[model samples]
Structures are given as C-alpha cells and as structure tokens.
Target: MPAAGRLLAERHKDHRKRHPLLPAEYEDEQLAVVEVTALWESESASGAVLLEDSELTGYVLGAPKPSPVWGPNLWVEAAGQAVREPEHIRDLYAAAAAKWVDDGRTVQYVVVPDDADLLDAWFRSGFGAQHAHAVRPAPTTRLEPPAGLKVRRALRDDIAVLAELDLVLPKYQSRSPVFSAGELPTLEEALADWEESIDDQDYATFVAEYDGRVIGMSVGCSVEKSSAHSGLARPDNAGFLGYAAVLPEARGHGAGRALGEAVMQWSADTGYTAVVADWRVTNLLASRTWPRLGFQQTFHRLHRAIGY
Candidate 1:
C-alpha cells in the first residue's frame, strides 16, 4: 500500500452520522481508507468485488487480507442505489471471492443479500451474514486497582497457566448465566491466537494473587483508536480491560475489583487518559462493577432476530 491519501477524520464524521455501527475511531488511518474504497482498488487487490460501473450506483469495500472481525470477518461493506446493469455484478462478486480465496486471509466477509441491486446477485455472490456480532465501545475510563490482592505484571512463564485458567473461569456464560458453560468449537483456535496476544505490545496482563494463589486475572489490551467519551487521541497502552476473570472461590473476595483497579492504576501511571471495557446489559457483574468504577452506558445497540 503506497499511502492512504485521504484523512479518515472526514470519513469518520460522515459515517458516524450515517451508520452508527461504524466505529467512531480508526486504529490505523491508512487501513480505514483502504477498507473504505476497496471497490476502486479491486484491480490491485486479489479479492472479488461487487461494483456498479454505470451511474456509480453502488460501492464495495474489500481487502486482500481479511481482518479478524466478528461479523463474518467482513472485508467488503457496501450499500447503494440499485446497480441495475445486472450483467457486471456477478463477475464483480466472483472476482472478489476468487481474490479472497487465493489471498492469504482464506476468508471473505461481505454484507448480505445485496439488497440495493438484486437478491439473487447476492446469493450468487456467495456472501452470507450467518451470525452477526456487534463492535461496541469498551470502557476506556480508568478504575483504580483494588486493594487486598497483589497485582503484578505478567510474564511469559505465566501464559500456560493463564491459558488454562482463561479457558474456564470467564468462559462463555450464556448457557447458565448463573454458571460457566461450554467452550465454543472454535475457542481453542482463538486461544491459540492468544498465545501471540500474551506478548502483544498494546496490552498488559496482570494477575491478582491471593495467598500466593493466582485467584483472579485481568488483561488490558490497548486501543490505538477509541470511542470513549473523553475524545482523547492516540494514548499509549490505552488499555482495553478484558479477560477479567476470577476463580469461583475468589468470587466475592473483591478479586475482580482488585484486578480491575490494578489495571486502572497501570493505565494512569502509563499516562493514558482512559481505559475501555464492556459488558452485556444483562450481565450482573457489569451492572455493579461499571457503575462502581464510574462507568456509564454511553449508548445501546439492541439486537433483534429476523427470518426465523
């Protein structure tokens, strides 16, 4: 990529007004523009495209490499007036898919149904929104590390133990809501990736050891771009407080609080103006901890099921 010619701040502002789902911040400015006008860059890219040459009625965003994202790992996002020419659309999509297949990413994320031009075009285009995920903002406001638990920076030796601990403690809780549940089939794969994440420069992994036992753990991954209300730009180790988990026995011992506060202090000491974390509206811990840490729900994105 030579250079992303345009400034994202301009596009970001416009997208915010039009599509609230678009993240308010851009971690990589060049990446944002490259992603935005992927339709125009299709010739240079290996990915297929869904385009409209006449009337310039439609637009698509595609990438040679698929980003790690939740919504079908999307690289193409497009919506526009009808692309009525019809003949070119299929080739466009096929080209894009071929590009993605051959590209290293080995995945293609596209917006579904191609509602603007043709439904079958979308079906033929080979794109589906099988399961949708939302990228809501995580809390960036710092909360002090709680007392009573010893907090310290993580080490490589700690990863194996952390990996096993992470597998269960804060495991997906949907099934019980009151108890921990099964790991998704792909969870181990995600865990494999976290091996690299344990050493990522953007984050800090801190553990709270109670009586020499690592009862609780908290991980903070920094965000280059953030949507916190503070509107500060480019804070280092601007921690994204995640992987906050506590053992069952340590549940009420203020372990979570201690781990959380430690991360906050580190964020403060490291000179970040804020940190970010999130919880489902239904999660009880979020209901308590967020408020206790002076966090407030800035916005709500409601989920709805359709075509059932």
Candidate 2:
C-alpha cells in the first residue's frame, strides 16, 4: 500500500496524455489510493508489488466482488508501474493472477482500454478484449425521424417491443469469442427491467415508431461522477445510453439515428454535459454507428476465463 499513491499519480498523468479521448480523472490517483488502502487494510484482498532497491516499481491488486457473472468473481481493481519503469508489468500481472488461481477464481476482469502496455501485461496473464466504453458531449440538435417515422418516449405499452430490441445486443455478442448468448437477459427479464425503469425519474426510454409499429429503441439514465464504475469518465454529471437497436428491416431508414439523437438531446436538455455508452469491439453495427454519432472510444473492458 505504501508509495502506491505516488506511483498512481505518475501513471494517471501519463495515461491522460496517451488517451486524450477519455474523460479526465485527475482524482483517480487519490481515489485509487483510498480504494487500495481500504482493500489492503481489509485483509481480504490479495496484491503484488515489485520493488527495486526498496522503491515501488510496479503493482497489481485483486479483490473479490459480490458477483461473478463474467466468470472469475475476483477483480484486478488496480495495477500500474512507476514512470519509465514498465518492465515489471507482465510479472506483476502474473503474480496477481496467480493469487486468483489459488483463491479459486478462474475468471478475472480488468479495464485497460487505454493502456497498451497494461493491456499487454494482462494479455500475458490470459486476458482478452471484451467490451468498450465510449463517450461524447451531449448534443443540442433536435433530431428528426425518417419519413413516416416518429420518435417518442416509450410508454408502458412499449415494453414488449423494447425488450425484443434489447436482445439484439446479446445476439450480437453471442457471435463473438468473448461472450455467450446465455449472458443476455431473457425476454421476461428485459421486460421487467423496462417496467422498473419507468418509475425511475432519471431514466428515459425512447422508441421510433413507423406506421404505429416500434422499429427502434434506446434507453438512457443518469450517473453521477462518484457513482461511475468506469474510471475513464471525468467527475462530472453524465448519462449512459444503452439498449440501442434498430430492427433489421428498419436499418436503412433513420430509426437508429433518430433514436440516438433524441436520447442525446434529452440528456443535454436534462442538464447532463456528457454521455457514455459501450459496445462490444466486435459489434460491427454499434462500432460503426456510435462513432458516427460523435462518440469517442474511451475504455475497454477486457476479460479472461480459465477452465471454461
């Protein structure tokens, strides 16, 4: 735990320069130090640190989470190297992963989208790219739907349609090496979530209707800086856009574009300055669409599964 803060300060400064597309997190150093200190002090987490002549050279920390939906219930919460001393990355990551293996954790998750060396280090430890987080400033443009299409807030009657589109993400991920269709929520589950979202003031669900039939859908909700799980975001008011999808027959129209624009405009009008969303790296439709919507790649959520 000692000197970890100092190491993080140097790493954070360099990370910002290398990943200008990511939102600022100047407080990450302090927050990381606090989190690591708490975990270390808890006596429940395991960590590995490489030292050179009694100075911290590199470090990796792991702790168990309450859930393990992604496989290994353990998480590599923090990892970094001192300025200009990246040689120990592989060893450090390996050491931490070894602890997970001993602790019966076969799957490990870590976010290192912007850190190539760190990502390489994790790759050496058996991790691979899983998901991506993207963000952009909320737009003020008043979006217009395609000919004969209309965009509106989804009502209770729209849950069935929205739930179907929600399956699109899982379907896309199911075709990739990093995911399984089983991970996606079932129609019942998706409908339940939509139903609950209706009561949440901070949440919004939008749909594009053509000829009175829902052809596309999008969902967004607010997340404060301190509540963000992705450390790539700045400590500012932000919103998350998700469940965005257009029916196969509706793709050529403007359903996807209109839904996206409306959600972003709603975010802006709701007083949020930035909006964040993510897609699997292999999700071609999302990969191409989000970028054109003005979102920039920010963080990559990488994963590795052992014995599965």
Which one wins on lDDT? 2
In order, candidate lDDTs are 0.49, 0.70
Residue 113 displacement (Å), model 2 = 4.7
Q: List TM-scores for all candidates, in order.
A: 0.49, 0.83
- 211 in model 2: Cα distance from truth in Å? 3.6
Q: Which ten residues in a row have the lowest lDDT in candidate 1?
A: 298-307
> Model 1, range 73-93, lDDT digits (tens) per residue?
224433211133444556665
lDDT of 2 by residue, 244-281 (tens): 88877778777887888888888888988877777777
Q: What ranges in model 2 sit over 4 Å off?
A: 18-29, 39-43, 78-84, 140-143, 146-148, 176-178, 181-184, 225-235
RMSD of each predicted structure: 9.5, 3.2
Q: After superposition, how far is residue 291 of candidate 1 from its true place, in Å?
A: 2.6
